[model samples]
Target chain A: MTGYIEKKHTFRSWVIEKLFMGKTIKEYLKGLITPFNFVAALILLVGVPVSVYRFTQGIGPSTNLSDNNPWGLWIGFDVLAGVALAAGGFVMGTAVYLFGLKEYHPTVRPAVLTGFLGYFFVVVGLCFDLGRPWRLPYPMFVSVGVTSVLLLVGWHVALYLATQFVEFCPALFEWLGLKNFRKWVIKLTVGATIFGAILSTLHQSALGALFLLTPGKLHPLWYSSFLPVFFLISAIVAGISMVIFESMLSHRVFGNRINHQGVDFDKLTLGLGKAAAIGLFAYFALKWVGVAHDNRWDLLNTPLGHWFLVEVFIFVFFPCLLFTWAVRKSNAALVRFASIITVIGIIINRINVAIVGLNWNLEDRYFPHWMEFAVTITIITVGVLTFRWIVNRMPVLYEHPEYKEIDQ
Target chain B: MEISRRKFLKSISAASGASLVSKSQFAHGAERFTGWPERFGILTDITRCVGCRSCEAACNEINKLPAPKIPFEDQSVFEKIRRTDAQIYTVVNRYPNPKPGGPAVYVKKQCMHCDEPACASACLVKAFKKTQEGPVIYNKDVCIGCRYCMTACPFYVPAYEYDEPFKPEVKKCTMCFERISKDGIPACVEACPMEAMTFGKRSDLIRVARKRVIEQPDIYIDHIYGEHEIGGTSWLYISGVPFEKIGFRMDLGTTPYAELTKGFLGAVPLVLILWPAFLIGVYMFTRRRQEMVETEAENFEIEEDQQ
Candidate 1:
């Protein structure tokens, strides 16, 4: 009876003939670069030149960065904001692999792949913003300033990228039918997950630690010695929120495959929503402690201070409450909406620290130039292309063919 | 299970030693020295400054820096106080109304070499160093140009040579280490015709500043500006007017800037050691559930086969 049911499901899926199943490698490659590839190619064609121009011309000419503000939209939005959004990968990886939650195994590959691509783009964005791109390795090998938060962040990002790459390799191996190689890759899963978590914790917090030294320069409301702790906790919330958001997006975009594969959205969203709720609660408490510890009650009335309050209340506080409500009610749609808001709040908080909060006393604020925008968009576009390319080729978005009949 | 037991034992050992590690982590046994001893330092006396651009002129000459748009003889430079930039390492700004009815106070703006300098602490490559004589200097040869020092500086003194296409370095007042090491005063200090600048031991300069303030309390502000600011700077300022009027950031707290990252820094090793075990434990606990599910599936398959 079980064999009969499996055969029936296979026949249903087999209705769409596998045209590429027996095709030559060359033919497959030729057929693979479709209109989507053309769009991606067009973006790269325009983006590469702009990126080259930025590289040749100094950051001063390429961006609207001023002496008053060292970091601008590129650093704030692209690197900082992008990294926080990518936190979903590590959070989900930990949930399924580290916590042995086999039920979440389906989401793990997609989450890890997203993280890997997100960090890759962050590095690309950093290269564009870096004044001396050639001297980038000096911080890693030559100088190794152990004391600087950037040094810690740089090392962690570098290491974590490698760890994420390793964690995602099994999917590639499985897709290629390299069963022996997949076993070796699977052996690395536990170690890589742990290492990735540690690196993520440090680097996520280190982003906030970068602002700790700028106590007087940064607005009092945002600057705290415990910024690293705050950032780490917020990253937990942000990561869970990102996973929830991405899962919904993926569900919509690949509904045919997901539904055919029997992807469990309800259970996944509930688990992610629970994680987000806890993270948000911790994050809210830490933010309050940051304000109270610093005795910054008077700052709340000022305009910049009011903006900070809004960031905390409207974005952070509201989404947190919404996330909790969604989790209790098992409202996947509400959880999805709250996750998007939570992600936005994380971006706002990062920008506030890296740019908005910086030079708060200055009347003239720094803004990004068109060239800077072009370069940042180019990097993000590249990331999206890479993500699409991987998802198309790897088993990240679907269950393994061998495991399709296995009941959970 | 074997791995878990070993990890549990390792964590127990680590937990037991946590107190010891915490103590050794921050409790730097008291040495009177805040940083490198015998460090080269600069001493600036605000009372002696006469708003002359001689030090500015001398610095340009000695460093072989670019000639200013306005020549040294231009007293009009006093109308606007200037900051150090890519081209200039030191600038003397004129502060009016520091004392009502008194002569306008001339304040030399430069890097205040602190006892525990934040810039040095912040530099990743050890490119910026606090020489034993009290001067915080940068080595361009080893510099990666990360500019962590620029952000860490409380005084906002470190300026990057952003315009330089090839190799840009952090430009700052080095307290004239090259000349001072040879027992010569800084070019700026030596060129002060009004004897506004004094070059001496940081310890001696503080005493000299206090004595001058005591002798003529009516002529100067009672407080010595850098004496205790951010762990006491090498340059001591005795101003006739308030320090804030002259672009001094008085809000910088006394704690050394590196103290801020100490919490996270101390936790790095702890996290490095513990996170792997913690995560693996979670993996094991989860794996057990997966195994149970697999077993249940196997039993269901067997029952279906029997039927």
Candidate 2:
């Protein structure tokens, strides 16, 4: 009995030290009562009950989706936009491991963690939109529809999620003090990154291909045969912009954790901005090419045509110009601003494709219910809380001192 | 009795062996599926259709759907157009006559049951199937309720049970599969007072529709609406007025919707095969370059030390 008690005592102290930062339970609870936590709690308090109401009730009451407009805000903002923004994982991985740009090695962990969390929450958000959420695995294990574009998406997301988890496992193993496991996972990094790039290329373009069947339904101005190419290029821009946007916020929130010696983050930001600028320019020229290809110039005088122009020129072209100026002038703050605009532009483009431009000729329009908005906000908050929790406990933003010499 | 039974079994085996040989001979040279040659279809004569709702009533009764708030006999339902829903599988809309002084034309709308169904191509779970019997059937048992079928259908035929909290299904016209599989006509066709719908083999129905248009060119339009639209729907139609002036959209081209996504799906395997090989090549080049740069820097430092 004494030996067992002593072992238990040692384990308890280790947990308190590692998980709680050597603070008592009371002090740890007190530390979590910040303004941000309080606001997040308030949002959850309203959002959770709303989510429960949605599951118990039917979709008709919870959302504004109809037969004419089957998809709504959940699919547009969560599944489509979420997957596009989460491209940072493969982007950063391929840049560092495959292309041998070792200067980007520091941003890899945070970017992959954000991507894993982003895709994880996208599936969570999809659960609310699916009529039979429990059968989500049916497409994979039960009956595979090989001809479907969605099947490609389903398989890629599942496989890529596993790949990303493997890529981020070194951080997790280091946090748990499993030195042997960390070494094994670090060795698998290049293979996992190559696999991740292949999966990302297929699925990101496949998401755009999902709309190819609806050329008659989607507005002519937005519909083009080059949709898959457009989507792939825009995803690269979104991935790079998200890295810049996320890094800006991470530095402000967790500044002390960064090892500032010899690592110039501002210079990295400028490099990413230059890449994003080039991507946006390509996307902009392609958008006009799409218009010319379809001969939709006559539509520019109409209401929806003007909206498309705003989406292209203001959101896409303006950001391209801003990013170009920022990179040339070496203005990190300006690059951050351009990234925010570009992020918003990606969101707009996705929503326009999935919801707004779809069924444009129809009489009835879909507007999401208040409860739907509540559910979306709740899912995002939970994701943020989980990210913060993991970043606090794991070696994500900083390297563990014991594993300092081991390069992943 | 034992001898007679053995002889019967021998004859049955002999017949089965002959059929198996013939089946292989027929399959020798065919590479592409030209669809079921003997599949049944319906010929819908729009001019003969009255505004009466007997077909709708019969469809609801045969499907055992919940009753509508407004009874089937009410004429006020024609004031606004209606579409197929969870409770109703078919609807008829009245359009103003194109000649200005004639009676209103009533058009019945339902699933076209195309030869190549877009829903079957779009379903990730293989929930939708295009059977050889000429009906695009849905298997709710495997559906994950993604609603992509609703998005893919060119005719907007599929509807969902959004009100059912659990076990919601995509509902559409089954083409009376239970009846038609047993060599019986669909409920709506049997219930038509004017015999507006004629049921026969798809090829025979097309021949009959062509004869009608060729015989009376002025009474019928020069074109059969569904004869070539979206890869030739099983439910063929012949109308007096232009199809576009009525509810039919002339803009949906003759190409099969499934063919639109074929290029993308075909590229998936190519990427799966080639992307890894190309990425590894890039990685090799990058590693070699990095090593060369490191050696160059080391040589420079050694020369500086000697100097």
Model 2 reaches what TM-score against the true structure?
Answer: 0.95
Interface RMSD (Å), each candidate?
1.8, 0.7
Q: Write the per-residue lDDT of candidate 1 for residues B1-307, one digit (tens) a residue.
A: 2568889999999998896676665566753446554554556777678777888888889988899998888888887757787678888887776456877777888888887778877776778877777788888877765566776777768887666645767788788888888888788888888887778877777778889889998887788888778777887778777788878888987777777777778888998889877777777777788789889999999999999
TM-scores for every predicted model: 0.87, 0.95
Off by over 4 Å in 2: B1-33, B304-307
Q: What is the C-alpha lDDT of each candidate?
A: 0.79, 0.90
- Per-residue lDDT, model 2, residue A326, is 94
lDDT of 1 by residue, A1-408 (tens): 999999997765443223244455567678777887787677788788877777665666677765556678888999888888888788887776677666787778788988999998888788776656677778788877777778888888989999998988887877667888887888888778888888998899888888888887899999987888888888888888888888888777666555335557777888788888888888888898999999999999999999998999988889889988988898889999999999999999998998888878866588778887778777878787677656655677787777465433
TM-score for chain A in each prediction: 0.88, 0.98
For model 2 chain B, give the 10-residue run with minimal summed lDDT: B25-34
